[model samples]
Target: MPGLNVLAGDLLNVMRFYTRLPLPVFRFEREAHALPDFRRAAWAIPVTGAVVGACGALAGGLAYLAGLSPLIAAALALAMQVAITGAFHEDGLADSCDGLFGGASRERRLEIMKDSRIGTFGGAGLFFALLLRVLALAELFRLMGPAALVLLPGIAALSRAVALMPVLLLPPAGSQGLAASVPLPGLPAWLLATGIGAIIHAVACLWLDLPLGGLVSGGLALMLMPALAALARRKIGGHNGDILGGCQQVAEIALLLALSSAANWRGPL
Candidate 1:
C-alpha cells in the first residue's frame, strides 16, 4: 500500500498539472523528481477532478443559497470552474474543433491546433459547448436543487477518468508537446483511476437515490469516451493533451445534458 505522504505527493502533482491552484512548492528532492512523471501519477487524475468539481459545486451551492435563480447559479458555477482551471479544457475543445474542421490535411489540422488563434469553427464550437453545459446545469439545478452538488462532482470525476482512455489507447499525434513528454499510463493505473471515479459516482447515486434517468445519463457518458477516442484517432492519427481535454469536455456536456433532461422528466430529487 502507498503511504499517506506518497498519496499526498501524487495528489499535489496532479493539482499542479491539472489546475491553477496555488499549491505550495515541494522542497523535497524526491518529490520534485516524482512530480513531472505523469505516467506514474495518472491514477490521481480522478482525485484532481474531484477537487475541481468540489470547488465548482461549492460556488454553485453558495449562489443557489443566496437566492439566485437556478440559471444564474449554474452559470456562476461554470464560470468559477473556468476561472479556476484557466479554461484549460475549453481551450482544448476549441483547438480540437478548429483543427478537426478547419483544415484540409492532417498536417494542416495539426498546425491549426497548435496555433493560438481561434478560427470560426473554434469560436462556434466553444459557443455551443458552453451553451450546452449551461443549459444542462440549469435544468439540473431546477430539478435537484442543492442535490446538484453531489452530481456535478461525480460527473467531473467520471469525465476526467474517461479522458485517460485516449492516452492509454492512442499514440501521440505529434513528436512534441504534452503528449510526447508524458509516458502513457499502464493498465493498472487506468484501472485504479476508473475504480476511483466509479466508486465516487456510484456512492453518490446510491446515497442520493438518483432516478433511472440519472443512471442512464452517467452510463451514456461512459460509453461516449471510446467513440470519442476512435474519432480522434481517425481524424488526427492519435491523442494529445488537447484531445484529452476535448474528451473531458465532451463527456461532461453529454452527462449534464442527460442528467438535466432526466431531471426535467422526473421532477425534483
Candidate 2:
C-alpha cells in the first residue's frame, strides 16, 4: 500500500482526469496534469464519483428543502453533475451511439466515433438518456424526499467503479485512442475499486435503512454491464474509453430505475 501522500496524489490525478475542476497542481507530483495512471488511481475513481454525486445532491437537496418541486430539484442536481464533469461521460455516450448504430462496418463505426460530430442516433440517445436520468431522479425524490440523497452518491461511486469492467473484459479497440494508449487497469486495480464500491454500498444501505432494497437496486445495476460489454464486443470487437463511459451511463440509469422501483413498490393487492 502507498503512503497517505501517494494515495492523495492518486486521488488528485483521478479527479483531474474525471472532471473539469481546477485542482491545485502539485509540483512534486509527476503526473498531476497528465493522464492518470488509472491502475493506481482506480481505487480513487469511486471516491471522486462519490464526491461528484454528493456535490450534486447537496445542490438538489437544498433546492428541495427550499420548497422547489422535485422535478426542478432533480434537474438542478443533474445540472450540477454536468457542470462538474463537463459532461465527460455524456459526450462519450453520444459518440458511442453514433459509432455503434450509424456505421455498418466496424472500421466505419470507429471512424464515425472519432469524427467529433453528432449524428441522428447520437442526438436521440443523448436526449433520451438525459431525460430518463432526470425523470428517475425526480421519481426517487418524490418518493423518498431528502432521504433519496443517500443513494445517489453511493450509486454514482459504484457505477463509475463498475464501468471499469469493460476495460478488464475486452481488449483495446485499436492501437490508437485511450483504450490503447493508457495502460488498462488490471484485476488488482479493479478489486481495489470494487472494495471501495462495496463500502459505499454498505454505507448507503445503512443510511437509507434499506439493506435489501440497496442490494436489489445495486444488483440490477451490476447486471446491466455484461449485456453492454457483449454489445461492445460485437460492435467494435473491443472496448474503449467511450464504451466505458457508456457503461457508466447505463449503470447509473439501471441503478436509478431499480431504486425507483423499490421506492414505488406498494406490495401485492
Candidate 3:
C-alpha cells in the first residue's frame, strides 16, 4: 500500500499545483520535504490534465444540452478550463509573448517576463489565444457534435504532456524561479508521462473511431512540442515555468486549429 500511497500523493500534488480545485488538505511537514518526489511524479501530469479537460467537457456538454449555440457552449467550456486551471497556462503564454516580442534582448526578455504587469504584447497574445480556442472548439462542435466531448479531453491531456518536453530538454534560465526550484524529471519519468498521454489518445481514438482528420490534428500538435522548445531555448536562454505555460497554450491552440480544419475536410468520425 505504500506504493499506492505514494502514487496517490503524487497525483494530489500535481492537482494541487496545477488546478484551483479544493482538494483534501495534505500533511504539510511531510509534503514540504516531498517536493522532489512530487517533481519526479511528472508521469501524473497528464492525469491531472485529463481531469481538467473532463471538467471542461462536462461544462460544454451541459451547455449544449441546454440549447446553447455551439459558439456559446465552446466559450463556456474554455472558460471552465480557465477557471479550473486558474489561467496558469494562459498567464504563461501572455508573459512569454510580452518577453519574446517586447524586449530587445534575452536578459531584457526575462526581465519583462518577471514583471507582474501585462503589456500590449501580452494582452494581444491572450486575446488571440482565447479567440482561436473558442473558434476552433465551436467549429469542432458544429462538425462532430457530441464526439468533441471525448476528443477535447484527449487534446487537453496531450497538450499538457507536450509541455514536459521543455522541462526535460532545457536547463532553468535562473536560480530563483519555479523551474529552478522544482526538480527536473529524468528520461524515465518523461517516458512514463508521455506514454500515459499517448495511451489516452489512442484509447480515445479507438473508442470514438476517430478519422484521419482527428489523427492528423493530434499528430501536428505533438510535432509542435520540440519546435516550440527549440524556439524557447533560442529566445530566452532556457525553460522556465512561463515557457512551459507557453508551450501548453501553443500546443492546445495548434491541436484545436488542426481539429477544426479536419472537421471541415471530413464528415463526423
Candidate 4:
C-alpha cells in the first residue's frame, strides 16, 4: 500500500509539472522530486510533449469517429489544450507576434506581449495560426486514414519537445512565470531523452507510411519553431513563457502539415 501511494504521488507530481493543475501539496509535493528547476525544465519538455500529444490523439480519434472533417479534429485537439491550460500558449503566441512584429524596440516588443490587450498583429497572427492548423489537420485526416489518430499524439509530443530546444539554449526574458520555476537540465540528460523521444516519434511516422512531403513539411514546421524562437530571442532580447507556448503551437501545425503531405504522397512510408 505504501509503495502504491508513493508511485501515485510521483505520477501526480509529474502531472502537475506538465499540466496546468495545481496538485494538493501533501498529495504530490516533494521538493526533491519537483520538476527540474526552471533553468533545467528542458528535461520536462519531452514529458509535457507526450501528455499534450496523448490528448491530441484522443481528441483526434473522437473527431474521426464522429465523422467530422480533419479540420474539426485538428480544431478539437487545439480546443482540448485551451481547456486544459487556459490557452496559456495560444495567448503567448499571439502576444509574441504582436510585440515582436508590431513594436520598434525590444522593450516595446516585450511590453506589447505583456499587455493583456490584443493588437492587430496579435489578432492576425492568431487567425492565421489557427487557420493553418485546421487546414493542415484536414489534409492529414484525408491522407493518413485512421492511423492518424494515433500518430497525432506522437507529433504533438515531438512539437513540444522541439519548443524546449530553444528554451534550453536561450535565456529567459523574464524572471517570473512558470519558466522561472523550471530548472535547466543537463545537456546529456536532455539529449538522451530527446533522442529517445525523437526515435519514438519517427518510428510512429514511419509506421504510418506517411509521405515524404508530409514528413518534410512536418519536419520543416518543427524547424521553423526554433527559428522563430531565435528571432524572438534576438528581437525581444530573450524568451518568456508566452513565447515558448507560441513555439509549441506553431510546431504542431507544421508537423501536421508535413505528415499530411507525406501520407498523400506515399501512403505512410
Judging by lDDT, tell me the better candidate of 3 and 4. Answer: 3
lDDT tens digits, residue span 173-194, model 4: 8776666676645566556546
TM-score of each: 0.93, 0.95, 0.93, 0.81
What are the runs in model 3 whose C-alpha is more than 4 Å off?
Answer: 26-29, 32-39
Q: Give per-residue CA lDDT, model 2, range 1-269, as digits (tens).
A: 78887888889988988888889987667667667787778898899999899988999999999999999999999899889999988988999999999999999999988888899998998999899999988988877887787777887798899888888778888888876776668989997897798679668866766676678867787778788889999999999888988888888888788777767783211
Clashing pairs in 2: none
Q: What is the lDDT of residue 77 in candidate 3?
A: 92
The per-model lDDT (C-alpha) reads 0.81, 0.85, 0.82, 0.68
Ranking 1 against 2 by lDDT, winner: 2
For residue 113, give model 4's deviation from the true position in Å.
1.5
RMSD of each: 1.8, 2.1, 2.2, 3.9
Model 1 RMSD in angstroms:
1.8
Predicted structure with the largest TM-score when compared to the true one: 2
Off by over 4 Å in 2: 266-269
Cα lDDT for residue 126, candidate 1: 94
Pick by lDDT: which candidate is best? 2
Model 2 deviation from native, Cα RMSD in Å: 2.1
In model 2, what lDDT does residue 35 have?
A: 73
Among residues 3 or more apart in sequence or in different chains, the pairs in candidate 3 whose N, CA or C atoms overlap within 3 Å are: none
| Candidate 4 stretches greater than 4 Å from native | 1-11, 21-28, 31-43, 211-222, 267-269
Clash pairs for candidate 1 = none
Candidate numbers, best lDDT first, in rank order: 2, 3, 1, 4
Find the 10 residues in a row with the least total lDDT in model 1.
27-36
